[model samples]
Target chain A: MGKTYALTGNPNSGKTTIFNELTGATQYVGNWSGVTVEKKEGTIKNSDIQVVDLPGIYSMSSNSLDEVIALNYITKDKPDGIINVVSASNLQRNLYLTLQLLEMKVPVTLILNMMDEVKRRKINIDHLKLAQILSLRIIPTGADDRKELKNIKDTLTLDEVSNFNRFSYFSEDVQKAINELAQKLRETEHRLENDIHWLALKILEHDREIIERIKIINLGAVELGYKLRDEIQKQTKMELPEILAKQRYDYLREISEQVIEDLDKSLVTETVTDKIDKVLTHRILAIPLFLTIMLMVYYVTITGLGDKTIAFMEWLVGDVITKTVIAGLNTVGASEMVVSLVVDGIIGGVGAVVVFVPQIMILFFFIAILEDSGYMARIAFVMDKIFKKFGLSGKSVIPMLVGSGCSVPGIMATRTLENERDRKLTIILTPFISCGAKLPVYLLFAAAFFPSNSHIIVFSLYLLGILVAILSGVILSKLRYRGEDSDFILELPPYRIPRLKNVAIRMWDKAKDFLSKAGTVIFAASVILWFAQSFDFSFSRVVEPSDSMLASFGKLIAPVFSPLGFGDWITSVAFITGFAAKEIVISTLSVLHGVSEGALVTSLQNIYSPLSAYSFMAFILLASPCFAAISVMKRELNSWRETGFAVLYQTSVAYLISMLIYQVGSLII
Target chain B: MTIVDLKPGQSGQILELNLSTKIKNKLLELGLTPGASVMFVRTAPLGDPINIKVRGFNLGIRREIAQGITLK
Candidate 1:
């Protein structure tokens, strides 16, 4: 028979790493707790056992979202067994969760991750003694070491998971109180899946979730439980929860005294972590250093190294692939119409967005390094101060940065944030940052209107995006999402040489997502645009694109954007098509005007001056995101109502800002 | 005095937490208890969240949280 087990651990304890190593399921393991905000399941490799990996939690308490989610899964789902992953160096705190798990009567096997790090620190742990003291089986293992990983796999058997022993850690009077409470609860004609002792303890601690549960089953139990806790609280100088915590720690300290041998720290004066933090997180130097780094990342990932590769891709696909396809089709005696559909609709349209894949992948590569190397969290810490002034937190920074690459993954990255309101606000504002696909639109306008200052014009557009995002964040917080994620906390994991395998896997995953999107969405959009411009209504060929079906449709919506200064049917059509995918906007323009890609620049110059052109660029920067990003936003946000609000709000903001820029600039000039 | 009274590199035992139940519970869950020694490691660049070292590991928490935590 197949068995099912769950993996639970504190954040940054390498729980997901063990899950990947053991199950061969490559889930994205971020440096912090956000990526795996939801539970994921995969079958253990070469075994019948199924392993469910839940989000990391510091405790089973339901105050925070992660805790509530993880706690609910364990209580409601009741997996047959649990593998408790703990950072060996931080065993005291990690084990606190283990004790909670044990009280719930789930069979647990402790996997001591980061054992290698402990060894490097020269600290020694007697695992056998610790295991015996806690009445839980402990397996000392490291995430990277083959031998240690093997030890974990060897213990994944049915018998091993069910091998833990039961022990009590509460003080005498507290234990007596818990016993009486459990006895009283058992007397009630109600059934509960959890061990009665755990329920009694949680109730005594006034866990709101469990108290609500008690109110349903036996309302009297709530009063009784609180009465017992009040007596316990009155006797202790410490608070009610701390009374329990003290007892647990007292027992834990005794266990650690026997199990952990202190190492001579004088041998290694100050850790490299300290030396690095002194500089990287320095009070005065941090923000300047961070700005310099962000500029470097922008230059290297988007323009310097990234642009060279993008240029190569554009050349290879546009010149070489088009030439080869035309030659092959000509030999096969393909019709001119068919050839036009194949070359212009398919290759020209999709290839525009496809060339951006390299740039997106480069951004992902850099983000992966920062994430895997542990700098992402530090950046959050450094930026949290400034961000809070805007009613957001530092955690919103990653999603915004990732938004520049692509908004789909950018919305997905908001899972790293723990607060509901903050996540929603970030999702609403992330798409405003100019993505790689929108780069084509900006480049086109800048080149046509302001050739000499195109670079500066584009740079200022990027800044405007950031400015608007922050301002919108402030307004949203003050109006709708009120408080910050005041439980603003993050564990500063020791920095290591980021494992290359993890970074590569993350990059490959992002690349595949980008490529798949480019293949399907852009391909379909291109064919539709081509057909719209090539044929008139009733499916007849039109010599002039102005007489085609798309032109009529563009004329209808053209007036809506008239106030923004670029209101012609052609511009309207381009705007409408750009919604399908931003990169296709330029391609749509080239097709509508019946000009070569190179000559489309001068043709666009004939349409609009620099003033209106800048307004159009501003609109594109803040408008509703593409369909792919919209779907991701829906998934990440709480409700359809929120998603609709986000979409409508973005488009409205875009329209107002564009109109403001155009009207103001027209008056000034 | 509150934890903010401690300078960087200063270590003290936690005395009390004058905070909301949720935030205080979270702090206790993260293993900060009365009498547990914690070092005020350093302030971040923007000087909002203060980093602390406890149980041989580091954590960054908001300064408002730090101000509510009494230590000696």
Candidate 2:
């Protein structure tokens, strides 16, 4: 039987590129159990070892679902041998989790990844010495280079190697506690081998899960823990865990001093990153830089390159693809019902989602650049103060920025936030940002209604989203959880020139997600929608009857939206279908209004006045997110009550905003 | 001086923590007991969670928590 090892690290730690090199074409990527976050697993080429790529996490402290999931899997499943991946350049911070894992007594092999980056920064490490001190097998692998990876694969047989010299600096009190805990363990029937001292120390520090485990073995362990903690405190006059941690850090510092040789010339890169930070992370300049970047992204994805691609795709689908299918159906003498189902239902519905793939790709392309270049972290860092005032962490800025591309990932990104209240608030407010999927819908309306000022209108819509998100966050914070604010601590990695290969792969991955949805869910949805629209449930002879099944159902709900100025059956149906996915709003409109290729703008103009169009855009912008987003919120928030509240709040806000826009705009016009 | 008074890049050993009950509990949970040597990392430009080295890891604590922490 082949053994499996997993490579895990924080985001931007070069994990993916390493995986790509190791596995190449032998990889299979799928979603983690019951979640949309991608799970990557692959067999190591020519080797018996299989590697699973878990999602990136900053810590395994159970602060977020990602952390919880990562920690639980490692502890419960217990991989054959865990590969602890860390950034070579950021060893000081990375060693924190490494120490935590060592304390867990997992057989860990440390891979100091991104050695090239460390070399570029002119930092030298004595790998053998450091490995001996850390009591683990250390491999310095440069992910960007494939030759180093091959070497790692060839040398994977070394196991049971323990370097005892790792503990260089243990406080006297901690050493005493460890001794006591080890003695207590020896008294039990079960052999407490393999770092029992470390486990006992963790228990004394009140690691919740460890405490629970110890309770199951012996309730008296808790008493022992209390005694040891008190003794340590009395002797050292310090908290047990803190004293232990300080000892570890001091050991790490001492080890780093002997192992790492920092060259003075490395100051150049630091200066460059700092100089860029002056403008990009500047208190006053940051917002403008962010806004400019966002605008460029939107412009490129919507009206610029993305719009051109979408236009071509629209023509291909509406003209060549659909028409060809119709012609083939006609020649085959296919039944009208079958023809309608295949052509109008399946083709139209799925085509709606398909058309937006280009835009999604472009949007993710920009996102990849921002993320890879390390600019996204700065965006979060700069926005932390502003978001904190609204009771959100700096981490909230990630979801908000991603929200502009797609609310699903944006909401999913909220898992980075440690506080439950703040996470929920960030999730609730994320939809206010105009996602890329909603861009076509916005373009359709703005071009129809506010043609000359479409740029300004588009810009204002985004601004409006930010304003609404902030206002809601503030109001909710005041009304709900008001206390000492949660602090935001983020590692600001030095900016580097983004790798084009990595950026392109990330963009392709995101675009692939959009295309896959179009083929599966959106295609099926369009077919179902077409069937509902074309066939009457009760055999009606007249196809255009007012009492037809689709018409009656649409009419039943149309009046609810009357005050918002788009109460027609077609508009109501578009809104309903939009709940499946935001991009469906445009496609539903295209189908219902009988607009073929190059006629979406004109058809939109015919269906709605400028005032109504603007109002409709506002409603969609504020409405309940798609099912995927809701599911993610449920998973991340871990409560249907919170998810239900989010839906209700978003829907209510959308209705009010749309009504206000329509009523006031109509009065003015 | 308190940790709040320490400049970036300064190093100190924790002497005392005078946090509010809630914050104190949170800190205790995070294992920030006194006598832990803390090295000041960079602060956020707006200065909320002054980055500090603890337990061989970098931790960001709010100014309110920093105010409570006495350092040498």
Candidate 3:
């Protein structure tokens, strides 16, 4: 059987980066915490070993949910070995976790990652001496450096030769208390033999999770632990956990003083961040600079260069595939129904949504660049004050920005928020941001109605989504999910050139997901929609879609939306199937209307006025997200009632806003 | 004085952490203990969340949390 190893480290310590390097995995590596909330497993390349990358954690103390996850998995799974990845640039703080892992007596190999950063600071770490001091294997590696892979593999696969030993950090009095507590724990109803010393220390430190985990109900042991903590407090003049943490740091500092040479203090004076922040985060220039950058991105993708590329793809799928498939079917003596289903229902329907692949890929590519380059965190930093006025934090911007690429990951990104109220509030508002799935709908309508000003029109729609989100956040904060605003304790990682391979990997993953969905869910939805539109309730063939079962269902809901204009059954069909996935709205229209790409835009013009079409698009933008997102909301919020509330709140807001826009727009135009 | 009172480019030693237990523990884990020297870097635009260099890394903390950190 392959040995299993747990990869653990502090957030932003390059743990996941090393994991990707070792396993050839393309896991998303953000320069922020909570990027990996759960354990991700992959096999090391060319080795019979499996590595599980745990979420970045500060320590085993379980202060946060991610910490609790990593702590629990490491202790319970009892992996064959643990690879503790540490950032060499931040050794003192990172090694606090290393000491705690050593106390657990697990076989560990320490990877001193980002050694190049340390070297750049002119710090010379005596790795041999440091390893000897700790009595464990240590590998000093840099970003993209796999030279130490052999050493890591050997250390992990080595048979136990009795080199492991547990270390102690507390003073003599605290040690006595731990021993007595361990003795008392052995006599209690619940006792953990192997971890008695660690448990005793945890109890002294008042770790609530650990106290509850082993079910130690000994009142005397607790009293002893408290007495010892009081004595330590008198001696150290600090809280128990802080006192212990300081001891670990003191130990690390001593080791560093001996082994590290000539660490340049001048590195602090040469910060590039100061110069960059002066312009990027300037008070008067920040927001406009952000807007200009975003507009430039949208212009290139939506109206400028992206449109031409998409037009070519459209010709390939809409004209080339449709005509060739129909001709082949005709020559093969297939029935007219088979020909229509194959040509119009299957190819044209899925192909309509597939034509926007270039634009979606471009959008995702830019987002991944922002994420990997560490600018997304700064965006949150600059936007926090404005968001605070809306009862949110600047941290909420990360989810909204990510949600633009897609809402599912956008909603999932809320895990990083420290408070439940902020997380739930962010989740509720994230769908309002037009995700990439909604971009196709915007592109379709914007190109047809406001061809000359498509860029401004689309940008306005995106701004409208943010406006609606802020308004809804204000209302919701006042009514429900109100609480003290959490602190914006975020780290601003230094900006680096985004790694090209990582960017390409992220783009490829997103494109593959979009295509697979087109082949499966969108394809199936199209076939079912075609059957409903082409046959009557009696299953008899019908020439007119209005004579079929779909129109009967559409008519029932069409009247409900007449107040916003475009109250036709065909439009109703698109809106109904859109709940499955937002892009399906365009697909359903193409299949049901039997119009190819550009012609569908003209066909839509005959159905509604430009003002009404804009209103319809607004409604689609603001309505509840696709079913996948709603269920993800249900899972994340973990309450059916709250999920239902989100859906109702979003749909109601969409209806009222669309009605207001359409009614006011009609009066002006 | 608290950390919030420090101007950019000024350095101060943490004298006490007057935060809640949970927040204090996190701060300690981040190497912001009493006696560790912390330097005020710069404020973000609008001057709410300020950056500080502690233990060889930059960390941004909000004004409210900074007010809770007594410094000398």
Q: List interface RMSDs for the candidates, in order.
A: 3.1, 5.8, 1.9
Q: Write the per-residue lDDT of candidate 3 for residues A1-669, one digit (tens) a residue.
A: 899888999877877577877777624332213333334677887787888888888788877666777777776767887899988877777888888888876778899987877666567788888788888888889865669865677778873322534445566767777788888777763445346777788888787777676554666777777888888788877888887776677677677677777442632554565678778878788889888887777777676767787889988987788788888988999999998888778887788888888888898888888777777888888888888888887889988988988998789778777767888999999999999899889888888889898777788899999999999888888889766665577777666567676677668877887898899988999899889989999999899988999989999899988999978998988998999889999988887788776788888888888899889989999999999799879877878999999999999999999999999998898
Q: Could you tell me how far off, in angstroms, the CA of residue A50 lies in candidate 2 after the best superposition?
A: 2.3
Regions more than 4 Å wrong, model 1: A1-3, A25-43, A159-167, A184-191, A208-223, A234-239, A263-269, A331-334, A415-421, A447-454, A482-487, A584-587, A590-603
- Give the distance in Å from residue A259's predicted Cα in candidate 1 to where it truly belongs: 2.4
For model 1, which pairs clash? A34-A416
Cα distance off (Å), candidate 2, residue A640: 0.8
Of 1 and 3, the candidate ranking higher by lDDT: 3
Please report, as a residue range, the 10-residue window in candidate 2 chain A with the lowest summed lDDT. A262-271
lDDT of 2 by residue, A538-613 (tens): 6653355244566678888999999999998888888888888887877677666545535777867776888888
Q: lDDT at A381 for candidate 3?
A: 86
Sorted on lDDT, best first, the list reads 3, 1, 2
Restricting to chain A, the TM-score for each candidate equals 0.88, 0.92, 0.91
TM-score of 1: 0.89
Q: Model 3, DockQ value?
A: 0.69
Error of 1 at B8 (Å): 1.9
Q: Is candidate 2 or candidate 3 better by TM-score?
A: 3
State TM-scores per candidate.
0.89, 0.90, 0.92
